[model samples]
Target: MAETTGGVIDAAERDLIIRSQAGDRAAFGKLVEQHMKRAYFAALGFLGSHDDALDISQEAFARAFDSRAKLDPGRPFYPWVYQIMRRLVFNISRDRKARGAKLEAATGWIVDDLSARALREGPAARLERSELEERLHGAIAGLADQEKEVLVLKEFEDLKYREIAELLEIPIGTVMSRLYSARKSLAKRLEGVV
Candidate 1:
């Protein structure tokens, strides 16, 4: 069977893409519903604010839909969407640099329930854990942009070294080195706190 332009072209998403390309607003809406959360989360992780995430996510889908005909039929869709998102983040970072704005903390360290439980043995322990999360986030914010990007992609997004290299257009070795440095720096910073 022939594949469609939306990549791997599952029945539902393929139908939606086809309808969307043909100017079906409802189909496009459905497409947004399917992908928006993932897109928003990716953007939030990169850009670090709800407002910026909203703008970046909306821009990415709009750009994707506008250029729908160029999308490959055999690849996964999220990678393409993520590329758009990364471009938006780079642009945002550039603008912030031009305006002399410092990189801000994207969010608190995302401790899962198990990690939280392990850290929080009592009320005082929980408070101490929260303070550590804040300090860790501050340390992350202090990292170089490339280092921070590498860490977030590898740890939070669970991207492989090669995947991160491709996403950031760096060599795999560079990704590994940056991740190593980031982890070492974070560990040193969080040593006594956590």
Candidate 2:
């Protein structure tokens, strides 16, 4: 079966993983270029801050380069890299939680960029949509790490259950369970927001 990824990079991932495993820096750069946006957004979905997301994602790439020997030449590269990323984000989240909540989340991070033009068409509709979005953001941010990860992969990253399971190294049933729990949490959090 063909590998699926966020973009055209899937076809090149195996060759790039092989080359990078042999210490080809240029090959790794191509891999980075291909996957950076996906990595950044993945981190953003976890960390919920643009600066933290960018930093953590870039650091994950650097660390992946350092540990390139462990990368399997026959496997898709992204899932391996995502392990590093998820760990980093989890650590950072733990640290932040220990330090207590601050002003980390803001409206700028979860914006729907296209909402502006839509807003011009209907003021009441815009207000309702904005409120719902705010509530949704709050709900997502409050989710436990595993639940949040599953939800983001399914809803934002648009990964299939099998793909999420493969990437996270969990069973497909576990992916469905996590997704179901995450959705239930979001629904409870959203409550009656309209």
Candidate 3:
């Protein structure tokens, strides 16, 4: 019953949402299984540490379940759960900034998928790739959180502008504007290297 542009989740998902809203833990578990990885990665893109992402994603689900009564059956579940996760991410990020703690660069979160290709390269090529990744990560880390969030949703999550707008509860124009700013900033940061 979660209304969507195409169709409120398909029958199975809608059924799970209904059951979850009815206090069915197993149904909620199923929903978690469907979304856990994407949720974790989204948090990873924000927090930059595997452990923190894992903890925040799990905690978000816990909060979501605790507030199950507020879940609208006519809405997609991930976005609701995402709002919880995003708040947790922003809170921790703000705390870290206040404490002057820099985010640690986790080895695998962002660049692991390229490992096979990297392995085939010579040491010099691999080193160059590693350096580029480091610079890119540093540049992304320097972005304002709002710009970073929009960039992550569009680039890493591969969500379309409309989807990103819906997820962030912003207008499509805002999503485009933020994305443009993020990309422009990155381009300037990476101008010489790339």
Q: Give the candidate number with the greatest TM-score.
A: 3
Kindly indicate the candidate among 1 and 2 with the higher TM-score: 2
What's the lDDT for all of these models? 0.73, 0.82, 0.84
- Model 2, global lDDT: 0.82
lDDT of 2 by residue, 1-194 (tens): 22643222344677888888888999999888878998999999877899999999999999999999987666677777889999999998888778887437655677674467558869887777788778877788888889999988987799898778878988899999988999899899999973
lDDT of 1 by residue, 1-194 (tens): 31211235566666666777778889878878777887787776666677888999999999988887776544546667778877888888778868877545444424556347846598787777677767776677666667877888787778788777766667899999998998889888888885
Q: How many backbone clashes does every candidate have? A: 0, 0, 4
Alpha-carbon runs more than 4 Å astray in model 2: 1-12, 113-118
Instruction: Compute each candidate's TM-score over C-alphas.
Output: 0.73, 0.87, 0.89
What TM-score would you give candidate 3 relative to the actual structure?
Answer: 0.89
Candidate 1: Cα lDDT at 121: 90
The lDDT leader among the candidates is 3
Which regions of candidate 1 fall more than 4 Å away from where they truly are? 1-15, 98-120, 162-171
